[model samples]
Target: MLQQKSKLAHFFKSASVIKILPIALLIIAIFNSYFIVNEGHVGVVKRFGEAKDQQNPGLHFKIPFIETVEMIEVRTRKNAEKMASSTKEQMPVTVEVSVNWTVNKEAALDLFKRYGGLTQFEQRILDPRFRSATKDTIPQFEAEQLIQDRASAIQGIEHRLAEEMEGFPVIVDNIQIENIILPQKYINSIEIKQTEKNLAAAEEHKLERQRLEALRAVNTADARAKGILKVAEAEAQSILLKGKAEAQAIEAKAKALKNNPLIVKLTEAQAWDGRLPMTMMGESVMPIMDIRNANESN
Candidate 1:
């Protein structure tokens, strides 16, 4: 009986370890089943290598061995790339591009099923498609047009990329053409051409100003000549009028003298001094005697 009791105690001790081991394993499995899905992320539940369900942020439970969860970020993402391409003029150019994108929430299952992950999706679809679209669109513009009309080129690229990326699980929110790099030779040539054009415009403006000045000087000189001519003509007319008046006055005086001969004697008497002339010969004295009598009578 003593030996049996000792064997029973040993058996109980062994059974106790076995029971505790299963409970500990069950606790571990329960802990592993429950997981926290963080904010900005969605949990994709896969069962037997197939997507079965999706879970939002917080605590979630699933079959331990048969089910697994993958957290996919559904936030906006940014990517930048530089591509080398040629223009219509066959000039080599470097185009830097920035893309803002996001994975569509409703399409997350399709995305996971199709590409397995964001990295694969970008590598297989987004990057190659973007580069191809840019290369295809760039050759439509010349180097000069590409530089001068950059907005148009950027819009074209964005539109083409959007078209190509259609039906994909990713949404391209915006595309930006950050920078364009032309060859050094082309840059130098463009600078020189611009400088020459500016110089030509300045020269043309200067010539126009000089022509206006010359026209103004000519007009001024013509006005001065006309004034001088007008003054000379007026002076000549005044001189002619004075000469005609003087001649008329002289003719009138001559007519008056002819009509009255006594006027000349009166003019001579007024001019003579109060004195008598002396006789020189005998005949002159006889004539002088009449003059002396006339004087005594006066």
Candidate 2:
């Protein structure tokens, strides 16, 4: 009975030892099999170095030691780069560009299988293609047009870049032209040209003002001369009218004398004073002597 009890105890100890390792290992494996995928990220599951599936954000399960989970950020990504290129006029220009992009969520697995992650994809494909597209599109417009018409140039570049990166597993949200820089010499020359043009316009305006003033002066002088001529013509007409009136009066008087001779004798008798005339030369007789002879005869 004692030996049987001892053998029972030994068997129980061995069984406990055998049970501990597996439970510990199983706990470890269970911990390692699941991972938490944070929000704004997608998990790519790789089986034996080959992508098999993609998992959205949340808790995800995988075969321990057989499958690996790589969490790729599927959110929008932004990158800014400065590139130097020439315009259609061959003028050197520097452009600072910003690109907003993201991995196509539905094609995340394919993207991971094709190009591992964002870093590799950007370096290998996105950056070079962006640079190439910018170079290709910039030369189609002049420097002045690029500055003056920035919207069209940006649209062109975005379209061309999208076409260039068409087959890739990434989606381009937008391309922004942050800023454009021109050579200092060109900028200075442009400013100088603008200044000269402004000066020329100012001079032309001054000349136009002077011409208008001169024309106004000539108009005023002409108006004054016309007024003076009108006054002179009115005075001449007045003098002519007065002369015609005097001539008509004189002719009427002459016709009255010819028509009636008694009018001349009546005018002479009205002109005589009480005193006798100074001279009566032919057959003159005294009026006082006739009165005396008439009184004596009576």
Candidate 3:
């Protein structure tokens, strides 16, 4: 009877250990299943295949069997791609490009949860959209335009990408066409054409500047001539006024002389003031009488 009791106690202890062993292991696993979310990463939690709101970058507790977590990098990342283009004159060229991009962290969890997942969205949608946008936009521009208007082209591509990536948690930092390889046959021709255009534009600008300068000089000379002519005309008017004043004075003097009938007599009295002792006539001195008085007496 004691042997039977001892065997039953041993069985019960062994079964209890067996039952408690799984619970202890489960508790350890639940405690150890946590993951860290870094500064530039967002965490997505799935509870029984259903997605939850984004988990922050701190400690999080999860049910081991029912929950899964995904971490998505949200920092700016680069993708280098190669493309081809043609010039306006139909010269073929190859261009290599680098695109710096990032996923928007605030919308990361929702994006991953709603639109398949990060990998699916990036592989199926983002990659194709980027390539398509680049191909479409690059082919529209000439080879040299890639070099000359690279900034504008980059901005256009970024804007197009933003529109295409609507509702997706993505941002394009920049798109740079790093290297452009042109066919050797077209290189010289393209350079010559560009040089000619630049020279022609410079010559036109110089000619325009010269024309404006000539016009300014002509206007200045004309103004100076007009100023000198005005001065001469003013001087002439002054001289004429002075001459007229002098002429008036002379006429007034002549009128005064005419009004004084004794002017001749005064001249004769002035002439007689000097004593005259000799006559230079060949004949003897004779007395002279006034004709008007003699006629009146007769």
Candidate 4:
């Protein structure tokens, strides 16, 4: 029960405060007056509905009931839209372009003077200039180039856009192309062409690999054949050298035999065996010996 009474009292207090707020505001407005410019926004002061001065974000003194303040945002804002245009090939194309822009703080008064308001600044001046820039730049590129080298086309569009808004109070920060819608027939053809190119490249790579393998096999066979030939040549050379050495030894022996004719008798004496001939020599048998060299030595 106490909690219910406390809640009722709080509700009545809030109601009284809401009722007293308007009268307090009216008295304050009649006596003292000031304007507060918000962050990222600039205040445009007007006297008798004429542009007077511009104020930065802070509190500023103003005459009551005589002066008014208009706020315009100076912060960056993004706008994206699908811009339709034709290419040099006369093919219709649609592209989404996003633009980041901001209004100058110092030019707030001029923007107010010429455009009157934010709606007029965007609808009357900004939109027309953007459309003109887009139409002027896009038609210069071919449809194929727009699909293949889309970056270049987007860069050209951005440059032309910046040029169109050069002398205005609006600043273009950045521009990006989000999407491009090409014809279905062109897309299909491109995919087919890419697939064919990939297949051709694969076939060429396979042929190159086979050629390299064949070259390696040929090199290995040639190396084996050369190695066998080298071994055969080495063996033939060794046999020839051995035959020459043997012939040289035989020639030396022939020369010695030519100089010493008694070598034959010595060899015969040495070969003679101490035994009687196979004749009936009986018990008086004596061994036949060649003693010619014995007499010569004596």
Candidate 5:
């Protein structure tokens, strides 16, 4: 133990240890003095609990342990608040309001100076203003109108909130009503009406389909009747043409017989069977003779 103590004394007695002790402390101090602001944040440097200046993103330096940096986000942020209010018709509605906001880098120090921090600023001033804006705007819209035209309701709220947030260190990028709770009775009635409307539409469509089918049937009947008439007319025309053809042939035959009466005698001689008929129709029939040869020979 005495040897270890002597070695420690000898180590502390060295000149290098004396030199490095101050350097090590200086290095630690320097490392702690510089602060890094992230890519999307701005640093609020405070000197003795008072706002001094704002620093943009990147490496920055400050007196060690004297100046402290608070990173205030300059990027856009979103938050929602649900509140109850009455409509223009005195109907109560619950609305969930959302606000998108960003800190102005230039006024971050001023914001820190005024509200001490961003959280305090939002909780104390912004929240009240938001509630006021909602109260003022919700009265302008009836409960039914709010349900039917939510865009208009949101616009009214945004406009009023924008006016309220004027001159603040933050810019109100946008405001939205995330959800609106309508009265249950109204919703039920709307659902019933929608159901009736759907049923009526279905009935109308069915009637339209049936009307089309009836028209189609009528057209089919008409087409079929026209087709039958056409076939009948074609048949009648064929019969008439056949009758005319037969009459022409008969006329030719009659003209030939008139020009040559011996053709009739030749026809009768050719038709004779060489057997006498047992009976006659109205009078006695004569036996047919070959007159052509007889006439020619004479």
Candidate 6:
């Protein structure tokens, strides 16, 4: 009977130890599975399907059975989508859109818990929402707008997507319309429209150039007029100086004439040089006489 009791005690002790063994192993496993959140990534923690907290880029720990941690990448991610839709004017068009986005690190836990976990968030919420939003927004814009005002359309869609994905805890940094695919008809039409616009712009530029040229001509004419006035003023000043010199010379000459009476006679005698003309009456000719010598003889 004592041997049976001893055997029963040994069995009970072994059973209790066995029961605790799995728990200890599980604790060891949890501690061993420590993860490091990489740069630009956040880790999400959950306790029995309930969100607990988010972990930044570093070492982190969690309980073995009562708590579990799932690392979710919150880094910037890029996605591309191509879509075909009808415009507001019922024009069929195709487009390719590229999106740059990142999961919000601060709302990692809330994102995992509230939105049916990470898988569901991507599959159910993000994909469908993106398709639907792109379809709705593209159809509201014209094909020409899709081609010409692409940046504006992209901005509008990005804003709307940011609002739609608000609760999903994803931030859309930029949404770019990479390519606008259209039928040949639409392409031809757009090309023609662009050509016409370019022609109009060219004409406007020509008119502007002509206007500038005309203004330049007017300025040149004004400058020429000023130059002519300056030249005329300089010539008038030179002529006045010449006139003054001539007047002074005439006054000096008159003063000399008043001071010397024989001056006129002397000038007359000087005017009669050796080239004296012979006097002729009919056929008879007389030799020229020297009036100064005759006057001296008289």
User: Number of the top candidate by TM-score?
Assistant: 6
Give the Cα-based TM-score of candidate 6 against the true structure.
0.63
How well is each residue in 1-298 modelled by candidate 5, as lDDT tens digits? Answer: 9999999889878867889999998998888799999998889998888878999999999998789899888889887899999889898889999888888888988888888777898899888888888889988998768877888988887888888889888998678888888889978987888799999999999999999999999999999999999999999999999999999999999999989989999999999999866544554476555566778899
Candidate 4 error regions (>4 Å): 1-26, 30-32, 201-298
lDDT of 2 by residue, 37-65 (tens): 89988899888988888999999888888
Kindly list the per-residue Cα lDDT of model 3 for residues 1-298, writing each as its tens digit: 9999999999999999999999999887877578677787888888888888677787777777778888878888888778776655576778777778787888888778667666787778777788777766766677678767887667767777777878667777677878778887667887899999999999999999999999999999999999999999999999999999999998997897789969867867878958754434445576444466568899
Error of 4 at 222 (Å): 13
* Candidate 2: residue pairs that collide: none
Q: What is the lDDT of candidate 6?
A: 0.81
| Cα-based lDDT for every prediction | 0.88, 0.88, 0.79, 0.84, 0.88, 0.81
Residue ranges of candidate 1 with Cα displaced over 4 Å: 1-20, 196-298
Question: Ten consecutive residues with minimal summed lDDT in candidate 4?
Answer: 276-285
Candidate 5 off by > 4 Å = 1-24, 197-298
Give me candidate 4's TM-score against the actual structure. Answer: 0.59
- Residues 131-249, candidate 4, lDDT per residue (tens digit)? 77777877899877877787887788788888878888888867777887878997898789989999999999999999999999999999999999999999999999999999999
Backbone atom clashes (below 3 Å) for every candidate: 0, 0, 0, 0, 0, 0
Give per-model TM-scores: 0.60, 0.59, 0.60, 0.59, 0.60, 0.63
Off by over 4 Å in 6: 1-33, 166-168, 199-218, 234-298
